[model samples]
Target: VDTFFGDTISMVVIMTCCVVGIIVNVFILVIGYLDWATRKKLPNCYMIVSCLSSSRLLLQGTVLYSTLCQGTHHWNVLRVQSALLVLSSTACLWFAACLSAFYCVKIATFTQRHFLLMKLRISGMVPYLLLGSMLVSLISSVPFIWTDFSVHLCNSTRSSVKNTTGDSTVGNISYFKVFILYLTWMTIPLLFFTASSTLLIASLWRHTKQMRRNMTGFKDLSTQVHSNAIKTLISFLVLYFCSFVAEILLGIPSCLAKSRWKHSICSFIVAVCPSIHSILLIFFNVRLKQTFKGILLSMRGRILSPFVLSFVLIIN
Candidate 1:
């Protein structure tokens, strides 16, 4: 009973967090679309962030469904759910990597000819890169269609399946192959994300140091931008690392069989990662932050107006 209650509480928490994450991503999408409608163009970085949010929204929805159906014995449904999660997560990682690359090119000062050329052409290339990411993610997810989720789950739960059938060994081998393939796909984008973020940080640090030595140590616009970008990248790195580790741990069959509560914690981390990062993105973006503040103020006003009117009527 205690175990069941704890699992129930974990599910509730996961569901609530997923709901909040979905709302945050929706707000990001709405804000991005409104800006694009008004201006006829969304900035490249914002475009990437918007795409990331959309992917994360899908991820959160998948997580919510998976949580609600945690006890589901339907292998086909679990297979589809796993496929969708991989697809959405791959897209999110690719988009985030692209965002980091975009930031590096636009803000990092490098005098190399190749770097300068890339900076010049990156804006025009962003659309193609995003489309390519989607295509790649779709291809990566296609393998899941053939996966035997029953065997996978059986192995994960460490049941004595081999005693019943020789096919269990073959199934395990196939599952391991697919798992490695998926990990490779995920790792590629992570490499890009880490490299680009690291390069940007190094460039910013050097530039800031030079500025500090030349100037009177007052924070100028460039310095402020440098500081903010570094902070955002650092936060992103930490969150991304946590999610990556959680994903790996969750994927391991041994890890899953060892401690069920650890699985819940990893799920919570994965579900919350995109939402927390999106919140940080909003905080860093001036337009989004201002718009969010305005919305909150308007909501507060609406909530208070009726109470104020009731108080006035009572006094009169």
Candidate 2:
């Protein structure tokens, strides 16, 4: 009874995070679409944001579905769901790395000939990079069709099977393969993300120092931009690191995998990363921030108008 209650509470928390993430991501997509419809052109950065949000949306939905269907005996259902989850999660990281690379090329004060040349071509390369990310994610997820998550589930639920050496050996080998594949895909984007983000942050810090030397005010526009960008990059770095840790925890074959509550906690960590990061993106983006504020004011006005009218009628 106690275990069931704990599992229920964990599921609630996971569901809440997933649902909130889905809503935020949907808002980002809608805003991106509306902006494109009005301006007839979406910038490369905006395009990347939209793609990231889309992947997060898919990932959150898959997580919700996986949580809901955790008890079903259908291995095929679990197989496809796991594949979709991995594909979306991989795409999320790749898109994030692309976004980081884009910001680095666009904003960082790099003067090398190669850096300048890459900057000139980066806009043209965005579509190709995005396409490559999708292809990679798809390729990484396809191997899941042959993998059986049910085997792990069964082992976790049964104690007698746990003592079998042959089964443990087979399970270890299978888990190692999955871990290797997941780590391979994860590491590719992580490398790009780390390099680009570090470069951007370093460049911005130098620029900020130069601005200070010029007797610029703390509130100077350039200084503010640099500061905000640094903050965003740092926050993203932390979230990415957390996501990496969570993925490692999930991928590793260990006793933690057998614990229902521990698994749920890891899932929550994974789910919260994209959601919180999306909110950060919205706050850091001027256009999105303005639009979001306008939305809130409009909502507040609507909610209060009826009360104001009722008070006016009473006075009359």
lDDT winner among the candidates?
1
The list of candidate 1 runs beyond 4 A from truth reads 155-157, 160-173, 254-256, 302-316
lDDT of each: 0.82, 0.81
* Candidate 2 segments exceeding 4 Å error: 155-175, 254-256, 301-316
Find the 10 residues in a row with the least total lDDT in model 1. 164-173
Per-residue CA lDDT of model 2 for 1-316, tens digit only, reads 9988988988888899999999989999999999899999989989999999999999999988888877654556656886897899899889989999998999898899999999999999999999999999999888776674534554544532232323221212254577589889988898999999999988988887877788744567866776777778889999989987886777655343566656777889988998999988888888887777666555546757776555434423
- Quote the lDDT for 75 in model 1: 46
The TM-score measured for candidate 2 stands at: 0.88
Give the RMSD in angstroms, all C-alphas superposed, for model 1: 5.8
